[model samples]
Target: MASLNRIWGLIVKELLALLKDPRARVVLIAPPLVQLLVFGYAATFDVNDVRVGVLNRDGGELSRRLVAGFSGAPAFHVTRHLDQIRQARPLLGDKKVDMVLHIGPDFGAHLHRGRAARAQVLVDGRNSNTAAIISQYAGSIVAAFNREALGNGGDAELAIRAWFNPNLVSRWFIVPGLVGVLTLVVTTLVTALSVAREREAGTFNQLLVTPLRPPEILLGKALPAIFIGLAEASVIVAFAVFWFGVPLAGDLRLLYLGLLLFMLSTVGMGLLISSLCATQQQALLGAFLYIVPAIILSGFATPIANMPETVQDLTLLDPLRYCLVVVRGVFLKDLPLELLLPQLWPMALIGLVTLSAAGALFRSRLG
Candidate 1:
């Protein structure tokens, strides 16, 4: 009972210490919100409004229709009409256009005689991903035109349907992952600073002199961060759904459960970092060292399958990786509890190991 009381008092003190400062309050609230907005709006994979030029040597009605097709696509804008192939060099080199569509003089004649007509797409490959997406859009436009012109004489059409995210909006992928990422950032920073702040202020010895055990002090430190992390996560989740228009397809309860487990693992890692550092600056640096790699390993921006085998093995220990699966799955896939168990248990295990390690390290430092 006394131990619990001591932990409660310490938790309250920690919260007050964090919330009472004007700068601390701003740091807690403003950065996460700003990052959320920035990442939500700016971080995207979908390409749009691609500027293109046309070199139509074929001066025929069918060739004009092909040019019209490119003009009509929402993804493409025909910015220039090239008189010769040499004109495309300056346009592409000067960054005036992303790609140029070149149709040969015999395009309509070949199509009219039921022979293959070839068109060339010259793309600026400086930004490879954007260039590839542009190529795909251009290919799709040509495919659509072929279907229309051939009147069912073309090759079999492939129907591509996106399941979870029907429109394949990048926000549907990014924002939910932000919930885990921003929560990890806030929680890790808060806890990582806790012991370091106390040591820097010369108050860590004061806590040691109290009747509170190491575990009690650790609990006191952890609970406040967990509370703050969960609150921040809730705000991000709400913004993801309400402000960003991302659908909440799964059970809210399950999502929160995953959040809780993820937070526990993150808090444990933070506490471990806090236990090792003696100054706030060192703690801050240490937190970032862990954070950058964690985000990279979490399969947030890139797919895990694409990583090299050794690097892939290393990601198994990253709690954020599991949390991302949980968050994205819950948001987009309507992931049930059973489906989430694999992700949840890894985080729980990571939490248990890291917390235990932190406790042992704290005790050793006390001696």
Candidate 2:
């Protein structure tokens, strides 16, 4: 309790110092909002209308139907048709099309006989991940057509009914998650460079020789980032509610609490990175390396279930993944304590671990 009280005072002092620094104030408040809007809307993996190439050798009603279906949706796009099978290689190699669909000469005949009409989708193997997702998307479209064309419906093991977002708007999933994610980047990146800049400008040495303890100094350093992260979160919440029309399904208090815990780890990770790197360039690079992979792996772009078991287990150590889980749960699932415990504890545990590690590193770096 005493330690926390002291940390609180140090945080307050740091916050005051932050207010006095105009540059720091801008860093704290501006970039998170900007990045939230930019990356939240722009950097989406729910890629829509990816260019597709069609080799419709059949030219039958079923082929037209298949072509129309794939082209119709916002997800899969068909722009160019190949005259010959050999034309596919150049198109894919040039990145002109993501996938190539080949409708066989006997496509209509096969479906007419009550047999499964098969179409070969040749995907560029150079980029297998996109190819795999594209294949699954194409397969799903074809399956739906097959079910409709043949009038077949049966029991499936799992039935997915998306609540709140019946259409599964990428923005619904992304905007809420981006609240935490974009804030994490801006807060951490800004804070990570703070110390290095202080060091570069000869201010850090003066700071170290002061009466402040190492933990106090660390808290002071992290204090500004907290405000930034919280502020970013607020901006995104408003954006989600007003612009995107995503409902806030849970108590705002829980959302803020979750944000704070997650930010603790994020700020800690930033401090940890700052303490480790000697130069701002190294700090920026380190932060980028962490951010890119963390965002990609954190169930943001892909489901963690799709990853290999080893990789999924490794994500247990990633705080962003847990934060994303919490954001999604609170916003979409309206998850109570039962559903939240799994997500919250991991964030708290990681915050404890990473913050402690950062504190120790800060002490060493200062000493």
Candidate 3:
């Protein structure tokens, strides 16, 4: 009984000491509220709020009438009316526009003649996930509108084909991009805490006083996790291709190219996170806190178009989202290099900035 009492006393003392730490309290208590809100609202695949540009060459009452309905639909908002197709190109490039509705000049004539009129819908294939969803929604909306207007039988013949992922396999879309996400998870936490752990264990000062240069320390700490991330990526890709039956459509070279740049970005971001945090707990909590939104906002599991208007626009800041485009495009769509350069440059730019920032921070803080 005396020994039991002594053990319980020690346990209570440790608990009390833990509770006394302000940082522990903040890490444990603060995340739940933030995470609950993030997962609750943003974790979804159902896409909405398609920003549609209407190019109406047919200024007839029919064209005018249809434009109102497209805008009025809750799913689509008519952002602008472009005079020419060239005008819409910038919006697509900027990702300000989701889809364009070009009402050809013959639209009224065909409808009047009781023939099928073609309204070409051009999608910003840059964001194929959002592009895919928008394509489906726009087609359905237009067809339903056409049926109602034509007073045809209950339906029109719809033989829609999905180019990249015909099976609509979720993993085909998700697994390739999972490479980036897994890297973020491992790299972010590991790097975020690499320096911080040493500091918390009370070894940081000793290490700082060593002969090793700051860049060497940072690289030495970061390289292990970067290697692990790369291995994990290769395993996941192998599993996806051999086990899950996801075809590696594009050349392996492009896949590696995309993955390489992406990993550089992840490692750089991890190094940056590590330099900012002062302790392991802070590093861990901060990594988890940041990665949750980073994953959601990446459009890996959820389509960006589904997010609220404000949130969708802000997703551009996440490097993972752009990386996802490259992975999915290469692995599934086999998109050409010309097609992927738009995604490639922004991420490389971000990676460079992250590396430069981390180096500066380490020098500033450690020095």
- Per-residue lDDT of candidate 2, residues 283-317 (tens digit): 78668757766676676665554465666676787
For model 2, state the Cα shift of residue 223 in Å: 1.3
* Model 2 misplaced regions, further than 4 Å: 1-161
lDDT of 3 by residue, 136-157 (tens): 8877777767766665332322
- Where in model 1 is the C-alpha error above 4 Å? 1-153
Better of 1 and 2 by lDDT: 1
Model 1 RMSD in Å is 15.2
Instruction: Give the clashing residue pairs of candidate 2, or none.
Output: none
TM-score of 2: 0.59
Q: Where is model 2 poorest over a 10-residue stretch in terms of lDDT?
A: 154-163
| Model 3 segments more than 4 A misplaced | 1-21, 51-71, 77-155
The C-alpha TM-scores of every prediction are 0.61, 0.59, 0.73
User: How many backbone overlaps does candidate 1 show?
Assistant: 0
In candidate 3, list every pair of residues with a backbone clash: none
66-149: candidate 1 lDDT, tens digit per residue: 889889998788999999889986686445777788888988877777777888887754334455577788779888888886
